[model samples]
Target: MAQQFVDTKIKGDKVVLFMKPTCSYCIMAKDVLSKYKFKPGHLEYIDISGRSDMDSLQDYFLELTGARTVPRVFIGEECIGGGSDVVALHKSGKLEGMLKSIGAM
Candidate 1:
């Protein structure tokens, strides 16, 4: 199921971005995540924009985490919301700690 894939990817990948290639928010989210300077191969971006399964996949995401938008950023299995949320985390000075907690830094 879609939920299974999401869970698997979130847990298996240190940084997972369920994004849409043409989404502005996705672009911004990518930029924000890039600021962390994660080691090579640490950041894994999954662009689901044109994927035929995106609808069901997104629905599953909404149901699983109440997140309805693209760029569903997950850090070490924790759903961290979209671009604004990521920025908020960084601004609050908590993003680095979270990254370090997961050994991403």
Candidate 2:
């Protein structure tokens, strides 16, 4: 079920962040992503902090992404690692191109 949800969201959205509301890394990711102007409904943040199945979802993410960390960032069906990764991408000036490629910019 978690896999299905994750898969659907990743495939359907231009940008998706499987995050926890209170996580510092999640906040950092959100901060960076918020700078972009994504079409309405194209950017999604799936907060798992309040869910009863958060652990299972994280477990699924570990299998899918090889990491159990919050703020699992995905761009057009690609898991782009976490907050630090996104920040680095932004720093390297590659993030804008990636967002543009997927029509999220």
Candidate 3:
């Protein structure tokens, strides 16, 4: 079930941010994502804040990624850690390559 949850998110969006809508770090992540030039099918925003399974989903993420934190990010099938990681990649010019590799650019 954890794998399925991950698979669905990775396959469903070019960049999936497992985050709370009001999380400060999540907001930071969102700001970073907005700077990218993703393709048409990419979902720019999909809020998962008030879901009934929110807590369980976080648990599943801990099992899947070894981290249970908001702003858990996925690029394609790869888990890219949290907001700071994303910012680091962006600053290092690595995020663009990742986006291109996934055809999100």
Tens digit of per-residue lDDT, candidate 3, span 5-29: 5567686348888878888888888
Clashes of 2: 0
Better of 1 and 2 by lDDT: 2
- The CA lDDT at 74 in model 3 is 85
Candidate 1 ranges with C-alpha deviation above 4 Å: none
Q: lDDT of candidate 3 vs native?
A: 0.79
Per-prediction TM-score: 0.89, 0.95, 0.88
| Tens digit of per-residue lDDT, candidate 2, span 1-105 | 888888888863499999988899999999999998998888999999888888889999999899999889999988999999999999999999898888886
True-vs-predicted CA distance for residue 84, candidate 1, Å: 0.5
Q: Give the TM-score of candidate 2.
A: 0.95
Candidate 1, 16-78: lDDT as tens digits:
889988899899888888888786777889988777778888998888779778889888887
Which of candidates 2 and 3 reaches a greater TM-score? Answer: 2
lDDT scores in order:
0.83, 0.90, 0.79
Model 1 clashes, total count? 0
Each prediction's Cα RMSD? Answer: 1.5, 1.1, 2.0
Model 1 scores worst on lDDT over the 10 consecutive residues at: 4-13
Off by over 4 Å in 3: 1-5
